[model samples]
Target: MISEAYSPQTRNTKTVKLQADLVVVGGGLSGVCAAITAARSGLKVVLIQDRPVLGGNASSEVRLWSLGATSHMGNNNRWSREGGLINEILLDNLKRNKEGNPLLFDTVLLEKVYEENNITLLLNTAVYEVEKGKDDLVKNVTAFCSQNSTTYIASAPLFCDASGDGIVAFMAGASFRMGAETKEEFDEGFAPNIEDYGNLLGHSLYFYTKDVGKPISYTPPSFAIKNAEELPRIKNFQLGDHGCKLWWVEHGGRLDTVHQSEDIKFELWKVVYGIWDYVKNSGKFPEAANLTLEWVGTIPGKRESRRFEGDFMLTQKDIVEQRDYYDAVSFGGWAMDLHPADGIYSEHNSCTQWHGKGVYSIPYRCYYSKNIENLFLAGRIISASHVAFGSSRVMLTCAHGAQAVGQAAVLCKEEGLLPKDIASKEHIAKLQLALNRNGQSIPRIALNDTDDLVAKANVEASSSLKFKGFSEADDWHPLKFGLAQMLPLKANETYSFEIEVDASEATSLELQLKSCSTPNHFTPDVVIDKKEVDLQKGKQKITFTTTKTQEQDHYSFFCLMKNEKVKVRLSDERITGLMTVENKINKAVSNYGRQDPPADINVDSFEFWTPERRPKGKNIALQMAKALPIFEPDNIKNGEVRPNANGNTNAWVAEIEDKKPTLHLKWDDKVNIKSIKLFFDCDYDHALETTLMGHPEDVIPFVVDNYTVKDASGKLLKEVKGNYQAINTIELDEAISTDALVFEFSKKERHIPVSLFKISAYN
Candidate 1:
């Protein structure tokens, strides 16, 4: 409780009046991202949040993972195209704490906000009042900080209401709607035929667990449901564990999600603790005896709340028809997961599908405020009909929506225009270009005809390409690999085949087949041998050469790196004599290139391999001959090794000896190095570090190059910098590279004691 009186002399009491180019209220996923995007584009941004932390319901307080539509369902770890501020948060979290938990979410979110120098974050502050001019545009916002008992007056050229509740819009005199609209209004099939103007779906607190063997004796609230069968048209009990999750049935029945949060919190605590007590007391399973409660969310994840009026309202018909919007900005693939409008057990549990496909497009028009010139709305607050909102309310879709809004805010700040100005073709094109650069996928209809490629391979294009390809290859059974097929190849001829797959599902593709000459020694191969491609959505073409064959052996083709490292071997009988590759027993070649041999070529031990076998007087040709280089810092004169005395000086040390020399370093400091110039007395072409020798502190000498560091056995230790500065110092944070520090000077610059110095390191 803070006093209402203000001491003008005190800094806390002194009302700080500030202005910005853009003001984003609510530092949730959407607001944070919007502020970041706008700020990155040179906009002076002020992000105000009612809570202390960012990330809204996905923050540590709520303890929900920031999942996108492409998240989960086997695509959890893949790089999302909706990678901007959200990606930065996730990447920072992963870097700081690789534990894959939500505890680090707030820190990462703050880092992202702080990383953008143009963004100002105002936390633990609530927008209490709004000032508007005669034109009905928001002039300034008054935010009251309960913690400091101070009110802040802020003015901005543009405003965004990403508060999830649309509080800013409501205060700014913007038109909005709550609860379900009349059936005639939206013409939604699942909408009640009668008008029951009331509260929308109940907010819930979600939790997760991994213990398998457990049947807790938890009795749900009389209001809470036991199964999905209680709802109309929901008969499937096999919808996976999510069907039985704690929050799957519990809800706080309230109209005002913002004000009723306390009630929701009370109900959530009841459900969470009740379930925990039941699980603890009930002797269901011995495995769950140690089942621990990982997290308990405080904020209720409100699915449907305030829907702001925008330039255009996205309707259910558009979703069903898969209508392509010229101003499309985001997409959603999750089904219309509408919760019941009333009691814990209500008729409406889910929404009807448009087509067999569960994906839909959302346009840019749905993201901005109705009357506010430069204001935008993201997340659940977007202007979509209640029916359409049911499908677009998922977190992943919201993330995409947030990303688009962020980009739109940047455009608004840059072009000095309103959100409606972005509706034009050129502006949308610019937005799409930014999105593509950031890896977000924009669905497009195929203009050119590539149907002939599938037809030539005796395949037909179906309504949806994903299931069609799998259906056609159903008869083609899997071998050692799960499912695969082999087709005979023509020598020196290029053949093309297209595979249509769900971009959201497929992670990668490998057009693997046995090498022609290695009849007995099967070398698992890829058509495009140099690069690895992610074949998620769209079509892919595989082309390879069958120049010669040593003997008559079958080659294999299949998809590897599936759910696990296992391979899916295609059918070989369809095109007999064609090889089918197996994923097992096949090792992928390391793409890291070899380093040039040091100037003083010395070898304590040597190992070499050559293509010795010949077929029909045709000798196998060697592609290239090379040896791994080693750095002997001890032999090089004027190469004085020393410890880096920056920050944690104890972490690293450099030394040399009569027989062996090494760089001793702790694996805690991250160092960047450039070129390694060693001075020696004699002219030599190469140098070698012995595998047996271990120097000071038992540290092995490792050669650090541009791209990678390799040990004596030529095993990769760490990813190296491709290009670096001349004076950079190579810091060893991980395993030692080589036991003996050997280096070859390009020219004889020094004699006596070989020295290596002027080692510089930078970011």
Candidate 2:
């Protein structure tokens, strides 16, 4: 190569032009999901990110675990994990990166995006300019990449702004709010006071540690704060705490979170180094002598910035009341968590969280900008009041809502309509049906696709599970606190239960039968009956029959109040629609067994009944006088996918001893089918956190590991092995005309029985 001679005063950078049907800015989970979803839905998408890697906060650069509705299993939201593309990502992560290595997680995200041919990925590029057309539409966007010394001009008919700071939205002159609103503004009694709790949420930095088997020495930089004792929350530190466990190592709520991000990062670093120094040399953590810092986040994970306005702003009332919306598109269940302005130095507790009795719906109106016609708002910047953002700002929740944005973009292109037009009555149903077909579950909404051939076929199974309760007792569980067994029952039915227990001494056991006022909710706020039984010192059997029948079908809680002298028998058998929960606290999420907030906060106070993580959470060993026939082959055609508190188990489960579980669909005439989809049990109640936490198994135990599909002639059409996902979409090489179809599942000697939620055939 030769250098240029007598060059001009300056030379411009290389410029490139790109076009797409949809342009997504920001590589966080929300934007990544949006781009991938739209790309799969037949849209040419361009994904732009300022960072080198995708996943934003969930990337190796920042490393915060992705959490949503399950909330670490700290609350009462059961079987509430987010579905659709995000669920697939989480399941994939579990299979490949069960150890939760952030680097591996980054690769998973990259692989997912790379698998889609319609997506164009641009990384290490920041968008700094925008070009607008007539009628307040965005015609094009300009971005510059310092790493490559290149400038990119990308144009698209629709745009989505998932950048953490809403950079594109701000440059496009979108209306936004930077701080919290007044308590009286939206009747949000839980709103924070500006002078006390502060107006904005803050940024946090995390680190990882490892043991070298030898003493490791560390010296702090000149900028590191030597006065570690001055930290108000210093006593809360521990040698083993790292990653998201140190989420409280935050700052910059009082500063400009967007403009002064560097300053905020520096402050967080100073605190992190100071905290490490304290752990190393402070003489309090003798066990940390061989530990050394393995990695530290280069940038802090931002909590909140500028929130853009949409057609309708979500408020505290919507979350607390669990309100339903006509334009509901998504849902959120994380508690409303708010931090203090002083962050690590704050005198108040690290955070105050208040949760609703159940998950609430999110409307489609809060997805797109109100003034910016062609713009869409996603992630933490979606339209919501500060109090509501405290719950909806989580990564999976943001990603789920952004998925709706992706699907909406498809409808916008197909109908030649704007994003706002999709919120109308004429198009809302279409949007919901499309999302449901894609495996996204909306709360309280069932898929009613008339095009599915299964709706017309008669479903018959070799054997169905009869609800007779688990009888094998494997261990004894002490009743140190209140314990409840969740069981599904029908209306106008009297059920009898027989429980075996061991008593340390003579005591009286209080058995309370309870159910939620709302049939679809898990909160057992209504007490139906109670009984007091006396127990002797030895083993005993207690039998109780319900005196009254419930008015409607719902899951009732058979609760045994705390009686330290007694221990109940537990079975190792685990079922799809059954679980045992305890009234306990998860301290990490501030669940104190029961939430008794001050009356002025305008929040509800209730007990938290959460399930234990497996290998430990076993069902109660009891017997029912009569078996209930709830799991029938006809359930396969039901509109609901998962078992609900208000509805019966919308699944067909084979008997435990059924050697070869089979399902047959018969039709009067031959039908041409091009595709077949099957929905299985992956245990939606488990919170599949993306990073840091290790899981018990790679594949969900309840999922069908091996299965085969056959046509009317008994010719093998397709076979699936080692399946771990909830939705299985199989496309035939050519359309098959048959009068019937049969599905056969391999029997495995495991705790979970073979089961299926739904099956559909389409041409």
Worst lDDT 10-window in candidate 2: 639-648
Tens digits of per-residue lDDT for model 2 on 1-763? 9788887688889999999999999999999999998999899999999999999999999999999989999998888898889999999999998888889999999999999999999899999998888646888889988899999999999999999899988988889998889999999999999999998888999999999999999898878889887888787777788898789898999999999999999999999998889889888788999999998889999998999999999999898888888888899999999999789989988888999888999999999999989898889999999999999999999999999999999999999989899999779889988887777788887547988999999888999999798867659999987889888877788888899999999999998888877864687787888899999997888987889877778888888888889999998788777889988779988888898989998898888888998877789998899997878989888866677878477889998878789999999999999999999888889989888998998888888889999998999999999888989999999999998999999877466678998998999
Identify the leading candidate in terms of TM-score.
Answer: 2
lDDT (tens digit, per residue) of candidate 1 on 1-763 = 8676766774656587879988888887888877887787788988999998888876766654444433222111111223334544543454455444455657777888988899878899999898886455888888988888878898987788888888878887788988776667766554533334244766767555444465433444554323333343333212222211333434644446667767766765565555545444545334455445545666666666789999888776666455678888776644344555443434544322221122356888898886887678888889888777766775556766777887887887777877888988878878865663343444441122121111111111111101111112222222223223333222333323333332335555443333223221122322322224565443333332233332332232322222332222121111101112222221111101111222231101111110101111111011111211112221112122211101000011111111222332222333233223211111000010011111121110122223333333455444434221112224455434233222221211111112232221212
lDDT of each: 0.48, 0.89
User: Which portions of model 1 show Cα errors greater than 4 Å?
Assistant: 1-12, 74-81, 91-98, 192-199, 207-245, 282-295, 342-359, 445-763
Q: Where in model 2 is the C-alpha error above 4 Å?
A: none
Question: How high is each candidate's TM-score?
Answer: 0.55, 0.98
